[model samples]
Target: MPPRPPQKPNRRMRGFEPASGLLRDRIRTVGEARGFAVSRLLTHWAEVVGEDLAARTRPVKVGYGKGGFGATLTLLTMGASAPMVQMELPKIREKVNACYGYNAISKVLITQTAPMGFAEGQAGFGPAPKAPPKQTDPAIRQRAEETAQVVQDGGLRAALELLAQNVLSRSANRAVTKKG
Candidate 1:
């Protein structure tokens, strides 16, 4: 198979596209309509799914697909969970339709994505998995503190101390025990 093209950085839409006279008003109206759909979708999504999931989901791009009978909603999601999408999408679609007066939007398509990973790591993703918390036990903490204190005494001194106390002591202990 052929290699995929390199992904480009996403840029913000500054304002309405340039159009003349009557067309300009139509353009602005369309932009506003789409914006309304996005806003309402976000709100509805938060209510339906959850704020945490909603925050992870965003409308990256929205436009007419193929012949323009349907609206394509490109969502940048952190991960692909089919059941989660199934639960959230219908509500989002209904909200979009309501926002547009239930006229212009024929359908809503959800495309999951990971913009950062796509741009930085060149990977299309749903979402990055949450990392586990670091270890924080007292024993580990004490060991780290002891090492830090020894290093503070100077690298050579620390190294000698470790060698004599750990390596050499273990060897001498073994020898003494074996002899006894």
Candidate 2:
């Protein structure tokens, strides 16, 4: 056998230390999932309200509600003029209801809690939307699986849109990744 040349040290394998390997991997997974969920939610907003409105409203809070069936989103309206939130609350409610395939949403509470320094320039009466109620159903699980597959196969953006619609329709929170 011929003597082999010394291989150059690679950074890819060295960058991630074994001490935090498990934690790092878990964090990565979580980040990706959160990103997907946010994307999906934004798409839903855009479809309901217009691209312009969606762009203006940024999500400020997101979390899985009780029983892990519903996802809540609180968004802050960037720039507005005179009680825009109040005027838009009904439309938002309608859109949310329609998105969930019915009136599955128990509440669409809105509040005025803009970030510090934002309120002075902002012009809205109502608060940001609160979390939707928890939901539990076989249909929601099935949809989560389907949505997860779409995300795994089609990259982040496509999966997000799929997930957003499914979550809205089913009023569910879990994002089930495809097994195998």
Candidate 3:
């Protein structure tokens, strides 16, 4: 065998780390099984299509034509919103294709149903409500504030305090969860 050239010192054998590697990979696999090859289309629906459109429609599945040549995306929407969604099909198709980083979706199909048809649409015809921030333990917040107090820059101190609070809050949550 020929001798190999020197490799980069920063390189490691382990694979690149994703934000939530294990759970994300598992979710992607499950999504693909349901014909959602681009899992981001499911997870980040609101970001891909603007919040307004996303609130009225949800991607149901990605069905490919015979021989897997053309892909059609199906969306679920309330009956009253069907006409609006129909009018926006082109825009939806464009946005969804953008999410795939290619012209992957050839057609967009809208399925209209009652407010709670097939037990779907229970999430309602509106943008998901923003989750309120989790409250940090008083003790944790106080400690973090004290630790960051010595920092000179106001912004840096605030950032450090928030980071410390998050770390402490997560550890505390984990401890409580484990005990329960």
lDDT of each: 0.56, 0.52, 0.86
Two-way lDDT contest, 1 vs 3, winner: 3
Off by over 4 Å in 1: 1-53, 65-68, 80-83, 115-144, 152-180
Higher-ranked by lDDT: 1 or 2: 1
- Model 2 per-residue lDDT tens digits across residues 1-180: 999999996756746566555465565455346532433344355786666555455434444567654555455653342266657666665676566565534434443444343643353334558999645465655655565664455567466755656666644333333331
lDDT of 1 by residue, 1-180 (tens): 999999986966678755464365564566456643444454354664456656556655467757756766655565555457657777666655666565455555555544556563232333467899543445544544465564545776566554444544456568889999
Q: Who is ahead in TM-score, 1 or 3?
A: 3
Is candidate 1 or 2 superior in TM-score?
1
User: How does each model score on TM-score?
Assistant: 0.41, 0.33, 0.56
Candidate 1 TM-score to native:
0.41
In the order shown, the candidates' Cα RMSDs to the true structure are 15.1, 24.4, 18.0
lDDT score for residue 23 of model 2 = 65
Candidate 3's TM-score reads: 0.56
